[model samples]
Target: MADLRVELCGVSLKNPVIPASGTFGFGREYNEIYDIARLGAVATKGLTLLPRPGNPVPRIAESRGVILNAVGLQNPGVESFIKNDLEWLRSKTKVIANVAGSTIAEYGEICARLDGLVDFIELNISCPNVKCGGMAFGVRPESIREVTAEAKKNCPHTPLIVKLSPNAESIPLNARAAEEGGADCLSLVNTFTGLAIDIERRRPILANNTGGVSGAGIKPIAVRMVYEAARAVKIPVVGMGGIACAEDAVEFLTAGAAAVQVGTANFGDTRACLKIIEGLNEWCDRHGVSKVSDLTGTLVPNA
Candidate 1:
């Protein structure tokens, strides 16, 4: 059998397949279906310094091969998360606490609180669902650097993973900016800004007007961005967009991602991450690959 263990920013993952944030929640719901510990790590839902009710109704809309959401960052506050879910979740698998904030100060405050608690603190600077502070800090390289630096300053102990926005002017530049600002790892591309309209109603489907589009449809764009960012930065990159299968994950690994996060697909299949993990093991074995980490950056450039 092939070794699926992988190292990201010095932390070891039993496998490279992680259930992306927002989608995985606290891993409690999915734990009933399968042992959540089987996962490389569980990224919690986007948490704020205070609890949020999120955006208005009609937050999720379905289209072909994709879904658009503006669910805001609705969640039980950071303190609540720590008091309620932290320890139980840690017993299952690694925890990547996905956190969001409306300002740099807020980002720092939350990071400071989670400093030595979680295995990793994933900065949700690219969430398009929230109107404030989410994608705002992720649009420009300067903000990306500044916010990341602030978050890193507060989170000196825990590994910080800055989630980059796909809507940025240059994904590579933003990624490099995060690295320069002290991000231990980078993850992209967060959902693309998209609009879905109702013809008869002549109005936007989502209450937030625009939402983040994610699903199988965004894989190619995500892969290209991941490759570009990976090549540009020396830090580990966690690639994700539309990964529902083993072959999909293989593409991201070959593109130079230290690991891949499985999002949207989880809504359609509860065992998506497990299936992909099994598939990766089988695929690697058939290809004579001894370890899955060997798959990273193995793409043929000229081909």
Candidate 2:
């Protein structure tokens, strides 16, 4: 049998197959389909200081090989998650509380609340920073550093993982900003900014007009960005975007990701993560590999 264990920022995961935030939804509904604990970790839905109803109707639309979503960080408040789902989720597997905020102070407050409780706190600074003149904190290197530093200050007991947005001008620069700001690890290639129009209506399908694009179509771009970010930062990188099978996960690992996360794939198959985990194990054994972690950043340039 091959060893699949991987340690990132002092946290040991049984493997390196985490479910991305906004896709996993706290692992409750999926838990009914299979034992989620079999995976490495679960990054819960993006939570905020207050509850958000999310965008209007048609928040999700399917394109050729990808999906567009304007969910708008809709999630129950932080306090509610702790009061209801925290203990149960913690009992199942490692918990990475994906947090979002409208302001830097809100990020700090939420991080402080979940600091000692969850296994890790992942900062989702991709949303608009109301305090910073409506700019996304994750878009600019400066805001990424500032927001990460503020959040890190509140989560002393918990490791901080900064989730990066691909819409940035420079992924590596933004990644370095997070690392310098005290992030223990980083998750990259958040949904790409995209749009889908209804030809008949001659309007956008989503009320928000634009949404985050994710799915199989994004694999190539996501892989490229992950490679760039991994090369720029010493901290471990958790790569996501269009990982539907073991091969896709392997691609991300070789490209320089410490681990890979499955997002839209779960929507298609409730047991997607489990299947990928099993596939990874079988592939490792067939390849005569002792541990899967050895594959991280193992890509060789073409001669």
The candidate maximizing lDDT is 1
Off by over 4 Å in 1: none
Give the per-residue lDDT digits (tens) of candidate 2, residues 1-303. Answer: 788899988999999999989898989899988988898999999898889787787889999999998888778899899999999999999999999888889889999999999999999876431233123788899999999999999999999999998888999899999999999999987888888999999999988888888999999999999999999999999999999999999999999998899999999988889989999999999999899999999988789
lDDT (C-alpha) at residue 6 in model 1 = 96
- C-alpha lDDT score of every prediction, in listed order: 0.94, 0.89
Candidate 1, 10-63: lDDT as tens digits? 889999999998898898999999999999998899999999998999999999
Per-residue lDDT of 264 in model 2: 96
Candidate 2: regions farther than 4 A off? 128-135
What are the clash counts of all predictions, listed in order? 0, 0
TM-score of each: 0.99, 0.97
How good is model 1 by TM-score?
A: 0.99
